[model samples]
Target: MKKEDEAKSRRSFLKKAGLGGLSLASFTGASAHIGDQIAYASQNVNRNSSPSDLKITDLRIAEIGGDVVFRTPIVRIYTNQGIVGHGDVRDGAAKEYALFLKSRLLGENPCNVERLFGIIKQFGHHGRQGGGVSGVEMALWDLAGKAYNVPVYQMLGGKYRDKVRVYCDTTVSKDPVEYANRMQARVDQGYTALKMDIGINLIKDIPGALINGHEADYNPYQHQSTKYNMTKHPFTRIQITEKGVDKLMEYLDVMRSKIGYDIPMGTDHWGHIGVNEAIKLARASERYNLAYMEDVIPWQYTDQWREITESSTTPTQTGEDIYRLEGGFEELIKTRAVDIVHPDPNTAGGILETKRIGDFASKHGIGFMHHHAAGPVSFLGCVHSAAATENFMWLEHHAVDKKDWENLVTGFDGPIVKDGYVTVPEKPGIGVELNEEVVKKYLVKGEKLFAPTPEWDKIRAWDRLWS
Candidate 1:
């Protein structure tokens, strides 16, 4: 009779509850079952999780640049959401920095850029090696930005400009007419600012004399001189003669004449000459009224930069090698060593960090220009930063001559440059996607494309420092 009564109770409960329904008290007793199902679903969600979820993904070297520069080996960080961010290690940095620092980043949320930056920075100091941390940090922000469906500039705060102006390196030309023609061609293409490489080394190989009666300066880096007496610039024996200065002045005049007076041109690669000589040459070139003289003295010479900026009407620009904004650029900014702060994104940490550097410069009333002699990854990174910065003067496009340069990256939905300006990508992350076809075509000899990095699996004892 009892068994029959219980069976009748179950039937009634099922009929009332519909799908596996029970009375209120019975439903309370089944709560554990529902909790078990919920827990099981949660586990399934985590099953496909990635390192980016934990915030740590190992980095591996992918060599991209070779005969073709856009093929730069950039670092990519994988995340749990299947989202990845690509970052460029500094141009020509040892691959070890990226490899070693990968261990330090394991299990951290890459979105926590400041936290990861502070932790991993203990592994890096400055110079080219900082490329590892800088690159990885860039990739993290890229990932974070994508995960949030925002641009990197938007992540920093907000953008000050929709499009960023770019400066291109002037093509080297031996013939005055050829150089002038090139300058005009750049103008025709709508480049607002251009930089010329003015070094006597290329002209040295010319028969008889490169510059009329002036003896070409024999730099040890370029020529082997038994008596390498390095005096300074004006008094220095390299190109001090009136003839040498005349040759340079003639080159400048040709550029100025061909481009007319509207262009903002700058000169660089003066070679290994002292500050005093550089100052005299700068003074001599006053007729062109250049926008700025770049690297007049090695960036290390703060006092010399101050002297150059003070003595010349032209604004002096330096700081491509500077590492951090506070320590590296503090002296230069505080003292007004250079009128502009030119930072290479690869060398200057990542986007947010570079923005910090730019903001600091603004406080000191200095202008900013980004230095990018790297591939698309670094260049795009600079684009995001320049868009966010307020005091920007111009960003550089080193490979403006190559039509294929912009094609190497897959993320640009539209034209990168339009009417002399580079428009910031509106898409999430950097708005660049890697062109696998281009990578295959330009891969360095035997390099593999996006291979698995299993070597970084186990953390070595040396990986942990504090514990």
Candidate 2:
């Protein structure tokens, strides 16, 4: 009877072990994520774990004023360690993305960028969705960099340069004289490189007869009308005829004469026209010798970009919408489509990703330029990445006109930019913080923009899967 009882007890214990109760091959075959099961938990003891260990805290939106309004939703990641990572969602993107990603990131190590990005990317589509991912990634990297005691660029295989050149935007006035005066003002501020607006649509209503029935028309409501006309690319129907192209050339002539030949002038905001028209416009700008034709064609047309680059002496450039250097920039680099690769780190997956894009472009004998127009967080991020990137030509500073824009970020000792270049910060990570007072002054409706999330407080179906 004693021997029979001992055998029965052993059988019961083995049965209770479940997968451990099986043969080695059977156990391995039967278990999903066997390694994780074996590692995260020990059969020796049972400790209660809940998804709240990964609860999301909060999401807040802040608006900063500039030449253009930039409303950024900054995401804060709160961990058990009391360390928080700051992230910025792309301006004009839905705040929900930053919020949605917060759930996916709960309980995971923000330092594990590769894994987190993989999971978050499943929910991210193109365009604004891309911005949310990029912004969240920026914050994660910022947190990782702080935790690791390194600048974001150092994580990107190390720094390649110390100072990043900035490009100043010069707005065009309806009056050519006023436009010329604005161009001179940029030079007065010690800007060596300047980008000006030249939208033919702005002047479409002017009386000019085209031999090809190409007289420009105006309609503010209709996208095809004058106000909307400047929005087309070079390849589309609203393109300039030979005569119209001459008129544009005359404007460029006046601009070049004012800024002079020595200053490197760039062009942008040419509207959503198609690629063929883009080529014509680019070719026309050759007479004035522009540094590059920025966003001349729609960003998706890589073939057209290449054609324009090949046809015009001016380099073709695009990137503000691109999320990663590898996905969008790699294709352009392979084809030598653009003379320069411009990336907005906020939209281009933050510091490391932008640097990688720049490095890739450099390998192809192309220049790398950092695109701006986001908030202080993004601009600071750009400063760090551009400082470390080589083959960097110039970064954009669209809000230079805003006296309060630089003040939005704190902990930096002095003006970030002196002369025409932005100096790298010796401090850690992005090297700047938000001025609570300034943020409050500029925020819309006193929004509670950056609150801590309690990852341990929430339970969800999705959260249970990873744990």
Highest-lDDT candidate: 1
lDDT of each residue in 1-467, candidate 1, tens digit only: 36676556545545655554444565453432444434543453434334345455555566777555744567877764667778887877765677677666766687888988887765555668678878888888787777767788898888899889998866788787788788788889899998888756545565542322134354433543332234333333343445556677777899898898888998887755566667777888899988888876666678878988888887789878778776788899999999988988887887888898899999999989998876786788889999998988799887776666677787675767766788888777777877878766766767777676777656585645675
**Model 2: residue 231 alpha-carbon error in angstroms:** 8.3
TM-score of each: 0.81, 0.78
Q: Residue 86 in model 1: shift from native, Å?
A: 0.3
Q: How much does each candidate deviate from the true structure in C-alpha RMSD?
A: 8.2, 12.9
lDDT of 1 at 413: 58
- Candidate 2 lDDT at 266 equals 85
What is the per-residue lDDT of model 2 for residues 239-306, given as tens digits with 9 covering 90 to 100? 45677677767777888777789998888876556676777788778888888888877677788788
Give me the overall lDDT of model 2.
Answer: 0.69
